[model samples]
Target: MHTSSTNNDQTTELDALLQILTTQVASLQASYRTSNTTERIPSLLKLKNLETLGPDSDPSLNETRRLIVSAATQLIHTVQSPIEIVQDYAGSTFKTVALGFVVDVNIPEVIRDLGGEKGMHVDDISVHVGIDTSYIARVLRYLATRHVFKELTPNVFAHNRISILLCKRRSFEEIKADPISRFDDAPFAAHVHMFSDEILIETLSAFSEFLKQKDLSSESVKDGNPEDTSASGPQSSAGLGPRTAFNLKFNTSKSFWEWIAQPGAKYEDLARTVAVVMRGGDKMVDEGQLVNAITTAASGTPIDSSTTDITNLLPLVVDVGGSSGSATFTIKNKVLQDVSGIKYVVQDLERPIDSARKFWAENDPRAIETRQVELLVHDFFTSQPPSCQNASIYILRMIIHDWADGEAKKILKRLREAAYPPLPLSTQAVSPEPKTGPRSKLIVFDTLARYTCDDPRENLNRSGKEGSTSVPWPLLGNLGVAGEGFSTMMDLGTMVALDGKERTRDDFEQLGKETGWKLESVKPGKLAAFIFSAF
Candidate 1:
């Protein structure tokens, strides 16, 4: 009789859930109608961003995408059995294995070659990539269900938007000719390889072990606050294997980068792959580090170009560890037309600097020849004493999160040492607010690890104020599944790989205090401003 009552309760709950799902789907359709030009679902899939979109594409569809998918997923959860959920969860490891398989096989490329949208038979695709037809079909089928590939019919497939970018190589001319295409597809591949590959995923797989073995106070606690591992259920139970995870898995006194950099090391391929991926991934992720986020901090400062050479007072955008000047290039391209006399500087290791030289030479020789964009081959770890009188902004995008707090401090301290510059004579004045008196800032743009809330959907912080789309509920609370994919994956990935972490604003604020930069303003989306306090 009790079991019957419980079943009745579940039925009622499922009915309510179905109703909510219906409403959400309607809302999504309405939102799409308003936000997009096309009313057709197929047309929407062909949107320009879709050509290059991936886990971190800019001009993102964060808000709407979150709403539609989360609603569907939540609905599935409500209807699906507990046993089924557990089974899928356990079986999901095969998903990663399948991804690795196709990626390694370059299956997407083969599909494209066979005949892009028209697709080819499984046998042809298998023959082209030289894989067994049955095995390839099975793998392709699994990915198609997840929407990696479009299975038009039985044993036939084609490249959908998502599958297109999975191809290992891209035609530079094609990407350039089509301005709408994302130029960072190569780096995107690198990132995909980094995550989808065995070694990196191993770290994430041991997320459960990260807890049981990790000393809470080890200073190198992985990204996200130790106190808050919300939404992602019991993390100690999180890792499947008890013996190893994260730090224990890669037990070494040497840092992740150092270990990877060792001469002719066996992990060389992994390191090189990471290097390429890091370069490309920057283009996608750096857009979040808006120039306005920096400029807004200087909003009140009155700039009288007449008082000083306007050129001297022009804002400086510093891209520290900005590989191949990709981030700096975007900043320069965006700001060059509106703002005159602005200087863009990209500082990185020797190899990347050389690569940047080649890139600029080919893409915009005038910038390099004219010295408008300075590509300085300087390692970031050393003291970055100011060479010029004043640099308006030092942008450390996606850099600090690569290290533990101790090392992050070291990086910040170097910038703090270089942050303050003596005011240029013309602008120096007794006035409380000089519009253009060598105002300087250090901007750290990365994820501001928010605590996982029990009722994440309820506490959804629509960060429109910080400048990103807001997610309504049918969307996961923190967005999709309450900050599941990029947020948590990266947070944990870095833990095992580098002993680094994505930190909370409080964590950054504390670091500023320790490093001697006053936390001036914090815009949402993790853009933190620190003023140079060197007296």
Candidate 2:
């Protein structure tokens, strides 16, 4: 009888502890929900001094606010515990693409088939994705820590609303079906890319050594032969592995491309890595542009689109490097949904052609059958397609930053030749020519070089105020990038992987003038990207 009484006392203590935890979680949930709701509706007072959008705001701000809030809420709901939340944010970088891959591959469907979604005892997402369950558990556990998905119980998984949205499907009709389409699809292959522990170690090691080198010139050395692990640099690094040790011993002698192009090298890694970045990079860009458009289109600060003339002046627009047709689709769906005779052209490398064609085939029959949107496999480095000569607006998203000034000029010069080929001396205009008409406007969307951009911290400040930063999203918080890892990675990754560098607003202004494309204006958006226009 005494033992029974002691057991009841223990049960009473357990219930009290449970009550405290329950109250805390409830409080957290309430705080998060309130913060998220407030973020969707920016105060009119907050619009002052913003570059991306002006005091003149999109008439559709109310609608956009509603959609953005709903999406953000669902995304936040995926994490249930503080530990899970921190892990979710901590593992966000690697797991973002992993979750993306599962979505791309339809892993959730397989899980649903095995009675997992219906509350089965086991829901092993890893096995469903064809990997060992333990590995998947580790990956998902990290992901769950970040809130990408959840651990309903050990080894069992369930989709948070965010993960549910991630499942490959059309969020809206006539837009790109999968979010992956908007971006370069290489990120979907991140699982394969990260498998190269050698490359990761080498890259990290190289960066570390380069960081320590007192003389920047000394940093250019690399292993003489891409195949030779022995080409030398620093001393006393014999304990390291071939790749890491090699980096410690040598500096990169040439640009990254030159190093990677050495004979007998496995180019697959570099190529896929580029493709993955190119793909994932696109979504960040497109989302940034959408935000910019919503903010600016109403004010006409950039284009004076206040009157009906805005519609008639430049009705049709084509995105030169538009991947998966996301930008084109988003613009049409958001701004020109009811407008007629609007044609959008999405061009990209040959690899995306099949994917693009398949995308158009499976959805948007009007776009496909009527040719409202055309997906073309055209290289940006090559001549501008003849069809683009008369396009009212030309949009290139994140394409310019991939190249330096010389190559950028070549691309722009080609665009000039395509749009306004120089007339022979015999046909020269009698009077000094004035820039007028549609102007074959080229809209280049890219991030300005952060090292020099005037408002480098504008986005971060806004994001922090938005509440995503104040509380910290798990993975982002750890990375010190709770707001937007996409931009952060873009800035850092370009420095490490490619010779391509981010530019400043002044850098862009100068580059535009040098290339013959007159700079209309450069508008820095809320997402930390700049929308540049030249005609």
On TM-score, the candidate that comes out on top is 1
**lDDT (tens digit, per residue) of candidate 1 on 339-401:** 566667888777778888898888878987888788887756566646633566777777777
Give the alpha carbon lDDT tens digit for every residue of 1-535 in model 2.
0112234544553343344345544544444345523333333222122223321234223222322332243345443577867875675447545664454445544444453444222335554445666666676666667565566677676665444434322232211344333323335334334333244435644665545552444322321121212423211111112322233434534344344445653555454455565566556544545645534432332233333444234344667767677677777777566656666788876656676777667756578678778788776655667665545566777766655454455556556555432323442232223244334456677764432112423333222222122221111121223233345565545444442346655676666554445554455443233333333
RMSD of 1: 9.3
Clashes per candidate, residues 3 or more apart or on different chains? 6, 22
Candidate 1 residue-wise lDDT at 155? 87
Q: Evaluate residue 296 in candidate 1 and report its C-alpha lDDT on the 0 to 100 scale.
A: 61
For all candidates in order, the CA lDDT equals 0.59, 0.47
Q: Considering summed lDDT, which 10 consecutive residues are worst modelled in model 1?
A: 231-240
Which regions of candidate 2 deviate over 4 angstroms? 1-30, 33-197, 207-282, 285-291, 294-315, 419-438, 449-489, 518-529
